[model samples]
Target: MTPRPAKGGRAPAMSTEQRREMIVRATIPLLIEQGSSVTTRRIAQAAGIGEGTVFRVFTDKEELLDACVAEAMDPGTSLAEIRSIPLDQPLAARLTQAAEALRAHVDRIGAVMGALHATEGRSRAAGRPGTKSPDRQAGMNAATDAIAGLFAPEEDSLRLPPRQLAQLFFGLLFTSSIQESPQDIGPVVDVFLHGALASTG
Candidate 1:
């Protein structure tokens, strides 16, 4: 019965980081489900927070949209690890690894692909050129560098520059429709890397 404690003296809670994390966690699936029009209210509902709280955290819709897009295309795979993949292994093995990696990248950000298609339509209507973002450009650069470093034979002696080869490979990865069979990608990549017609008699 001494000091009677300091009633209501406990410090106010600090949950800013937690709130932000929750918002980010909810953003991806919502974006996936609702396309890019995902409103602040929608995000708040997904995150289980008040609509006002979303605005308190994000300055505007554009800022939040940009953040969500960035997260979607992160490429989760590390550059070093990608470089370490056995590119020099037999062509079949290399192709398998490359196919799996490409699949993984798409799986992680597959939801964005639909949005990208819509964006492309708008850009084309406006006569704008569609291109990869700086981050994606850098990723392409790193991937090509890795390919050149590993499979020197692919373009080392070939007349085409490493960059051109990189472009071809990048296009193959990004543009080919998601075929049901993985084997389909292999020959497609081959036709891309090697000519469709073979010289063998």
Candidate 2:
């Protein structure tokens, strides 16, 4: 007979989504520690699941890795918080908060992408050898859309369209993530909100 999936000598108390999230979370440290050589066995052990259950949840190693990457990169929770920001708050305060939020999200994804590149993305991803993984691209688009929404309410005050603002904001975030010139989002947001030209009045 097929055996039950056990946890602490009892069945695991988790739904499919919860189980999948747990396994993906467990995969994070392994992906960092083991690189491309990370095995399903290790993930199963970390997740406290039977090896067969891992396959049942994810079709194969590539699929599992994709799920892990997607989960790690998803900005849903962060976006929700950004969405709930009081629209009546001062524009500088709102934008500063948004910049900090995006910075934190980018930092996390940067680390995960670094690890993934070491695992496999350094070679064949999809288009060119150095192109971003599909999951990363999707995550980027999602983040841009969410940030764009944050700017939409202030379209009347912005010199540029909300979408354009979103693009520039992301550009600043991507640039700052790689370089040491600017220490944090504070300066970036200042220039983004105030512009380079000095006040005439």
Candidate 3:
């Protein structure tokens, strides 16, 4: 017999790993609502676990914050879902679907992006160019490539250097304090993907 999914459906069983995941899930909302000044006791309370458990799993607040940042930025939406969308679909429609999926999966990605941008700016001001860890840079590279593939088969318009544009997109997503509504970001990303300056002038 096929095994049943977790309580939230498709999330697997509520093992220790699941508990850790749940705790991380709880951390973001708390961080957003309360700001980064959140204490371990508060995080544990929000996670509905004993305060000691938080320490047991994560060595300290910095470790927990790192975990929170990692989880918050991850695109929870599966690439398979995007691939399943009909190939014949119009570029606008496909792009809209992808944006919506991104919005849903990493709703808090904006916050994380903002943090990264701030760090980058500070590093630049301090004369530490591209100081982000090798691992982070690698992850950013991978995310860029994956994002680029979403615009396949429409080479003339959608095609851009994935590596370079990925840097721009990541910078824009993180640096700009744009509180764009769903409708806004769709066309904005389109213009960005297809050269707005050229179209306007």
Candidate 4:
């Protein structure tokens, strides 16, 4: 369940990580629906805390956004499921399952990259000189690495590199537009399993 601040204008004493996680989790929906336009006021309302509490927990709005990206990137919930993929399954079957899982993950964090991008459009966020923050890059790299681990067991039969395939698959997932999406992801998986080349015999 979503967390709410304690009653009587008092917040329960929460550790640093606890407060950060609560704020990030509360902000997740706002980020998805509103992108970078989400404000601390909205986050505060969602979190059931005073607006000042947000700054107390984070140095500034940029830091809050940074933490949100990190939270979104963490595979803690899904890592176990990915690792549990049955090795005996056919490569295609396994990959399709991976695709489905990845799709759900992408949907969960829809437009998160866009939010980060839009935020940076104003100016570079803390912790990096580039358009994207190091935290964002770290999160992305961690997600790709976890996905690659899923493909490792089947690497012996894969012509394309597992990690490369993981990266490409996620790239497609991330950039996919909701309105432009097909009726289902099956066709996308089909294309991934078999690309532009066709049988000419």
List all candidate RMSDs to the true structure. 9.1, 6.0, 7.4, 5.9
- Tens-place lDDT per residue, model 4, 14-83, is 8877888889989878886677778899999999999999999888777777677656655556655666
Candidate 3: TM-score? Answer: 0.57
The candidate, 2 or 3, that scores higher on TM-score is: 2
TM-score of 1: 0.54
Best by TM-score: 2
For model 4, the superposed segments whose C-alpha errors exceed 4 Å read 1-12, 73-80, 86-91, 104-110, 116-184, 188-201
In model 3, the runs with Cα more than 4 Å from the true position are 1-16, 75-88, 100-134, 153-179, 189-201
Task: Assess the local accuracy of residue 43 in candidate 2 as a C-alpha lDDT between 0 and 100.
Answer: 90
Residues 1-201, candidate 1: write the lDDT tens digits: 113335687544436665655677787687666666667898888787789988887776555655566555665464455566765576545645665665666665666546545544111112223433537676667766665554554654666776666567667766877573566677776776567799797
The digit string of per-residue lDDT tens for model 2 on 1-201 reads: 223779678765677777778788898778766765788998999988899989888777777666666655667767776777777887666766766666666566666667778766422233233334556667677767777777766788778887788888878766664442234556777787787787999
Error of 2 at 161 (Å): 3.6
User: TM per model?
Assistant: 0.54, 0.66, 0.57, 0.58
Q: Which candidate model has the greater lDDT, 1 or 2?
A: 2
> Clash number for every model?
0, 0, 0, 0
Name the 10 consecutive residues with the lowest summed lDDT in model 3.
121-130
Task: Give the alpha carbon lDDT tens digit for every residue of 23-125 in model 3.
Answer: 8888878766655567788988888888998877776666666666666655534344554666577766765565555555556766654554554421111
Ranking by lDDT: 2, 4, 1, 3
- What candidate 2 gets wrong by more than 4 Å, as runs, is 1-17, 119-142, 152-155, 176-183, 197-201
Clashing pairs in 2: none
| Error at 110, model 3, angstroms | 4.6
